[model samples]
Target: MATPEDTPSQSDSTLSGCIRPFLTKSGLTVRCQSRVRSQCPSCAELYRGDWAAIARSGVFDGPVQNFRFYLLTLTAPSFGRVHRVPKAEGAKVSRCGCGARHSVTDANLRGVPLDEASYDYAGLVAWNRDSGLLWDRTRRRLRDYWPSVEFFVVREWQDRGALHLHTLVRIARAEAPRPALLGESARTANAFSKVDGAFVSWGEQGDCQAFRADGDGAKAIWYLSKALNYVLKDAVRASGGGARSWGHLARLSTAARMVRCSPGCVPRDCPSHTHTRYGARGHVVSASRRTKNRTGWSFTGMTRKRQRELRSEWVTAQAARAESAPAEWAVGVLEARAGRAGRELRSRVDVLP
Candidate 1:
């Protein structure tokens, strides 16, 4: 019964430029600037580049000997037992809790719960919801121990859809703790959620490694690039997995929908996408902000605002240069004027004869 007008257009011929673009008040075409790789890869790459520059400034902009940098990783407590499957090639993995040795190619079962009925789906969702608060408490504890600490943290999604944190921590050399001690302090830090008053803590798996900005420049740069890529890469690929993986995600989604995100939230009526995204809500990447008494995350005090201002200045300068140069249309205007003048002269002479 659908006519051509009723049917939606499928052709991409009308689309051009950015996948998501909008007009500013001044009629400038501006992209939506999504940081999610799945939404708009070009904008996401730009987002990663901007953050990478800021992260690099924190490491390389100051005297390298004055500061000590550590890469720290923290994970969420296990909600339940999952398959012990490895994705890397030739990685040694023992028998899973379900009494089977999963191979590297068993991708679909990698994060699937050993027993779906017994898996703590609600607990997993709650932890993801309160993860930001947990990190805040952990960072505060670190600052209490060493007041000179500044950090850049990225939240990444595990194969099981849980959120884990990777932090680039900086401290004055005089106050820096041993890398092992730093990791232990962070791993043991705990918090109580404000929403539902749930106890939150990190997993036992924590690690920290110290690196020097002044060390072999090539290796340092390579490591930095890899870290940035790890942070910016898509958290979850939208692939069609086998039954076990699909069912595991479905249970998580259902748990997310049923849980209360806030004190007054109605689970069924709330419009927040936290329920849809496996209860993950908040900024995935964050850095310490400059304060009156602190150097903050970036030693150079670089920020996204500074980047925007620089781009605006460049655009203005380009416009000025364009206006100063003679345009191609100006030549045509001069030629038309000369032709009109000659015709006028000829007409006057003919009248005189």
Candidate 2:
């Protein structure tokens, strides 16, 4: 005899395919499609891979000789001095600013400030809050100099928990400036905070390297794709420097809480998550958009919306196949057996009456 549990439902079968399924407002079951690795590794990896594909299209889909590409890194201006322990493969320094010869493995003290009381937590919070504006100003400044400039940028968290940017910039070869000049221009660009009127700028440790769309360009794209892993990470949750690091983050959180998010922001009653996430309130990854005068970030026009459409199509096709599978020999056999069992039970009930 077949039990009720053995009965297959179309909705249940389809929903079972997703690791984290949920119901829509109209009662449609669907995958959550979260980008955070902690929430959904499957969707996060897919998101990373899709962006990587779009990034490579910009570099490889067009004429290799007509355009110039550069990988640029911009850092946040220092709010306070902190220990600078080098990584295992990084260049060795004799002594950090704290007058201690720190080893590469001294992870706990690497980004921790020497004087916690004197550290500028408010300034750091303010800088994090205003970093998106700073990048916007920097990009516009670059485009003013070279009209053909297109870019893809990713925001990453430094060991000290400050936000920094990694950008891939593309420009017409005929109009491109020297790599140093471009980097210097971007690094020197400044923005005034709209919320509090404070000046925001990049640190002096900026870098830019030019690479062609052939030969060594493959390595550059690989590097950018690898960096996509950082996009979905939580800055405060990812830090692991022991009690000193925890204390550092706690102070930053407090500062973020007290800081005004916007002109009309009320500190205690504000509903923004910027207060919880250390004053970060912008997208982690971004690219230039297509315009009449420009080709945009992805040369092939790949986008998130397009990816979603393709995914929906795939899901629909799978559902159709599942619906049709009952006509197959194995499923037909199971259905016939269940029907016979059902009739036998009905006959038994009739005899009992």
TM-score against truth, every candidate:
0.84, 0.84
lDDT of 1 by residue, 1-353 (tens): 22322222221111122478777799666667778777887678778888998989888998879988888999988888999888888888898998888887788997888888988999999899998889999999999999999998888888788999888899999999999999999999999988889899999888898887886667667657656776566655354468888889888889999988888999899998778878878877889999999999998899988987776676556444434543533454466669999999988995785
Per-prediction tally of clashes: 0, 0
Regions more than 4 Å wrong, model 2: 1-20, 89-91, 322-353
TM-score of 1: 0.84
Instruction: Name every residue pair that clashes in candidate 1.
Output: none
Q: Per-residue CA lDDT of candidate 2, range 1-353, in tens?
A: 22223334434433433468678899877766666777777666676777777787788888768888888999998878998887785667778887888886687887788888998989988899999999999989999999999998888888777888989899999999899999999999999999999999999899988877777766766667655767777555666667887888888889999999999999889989789878888877778888787799888777877877886677567555545563453465488779999999988995785
Clashing pairs in 2: none
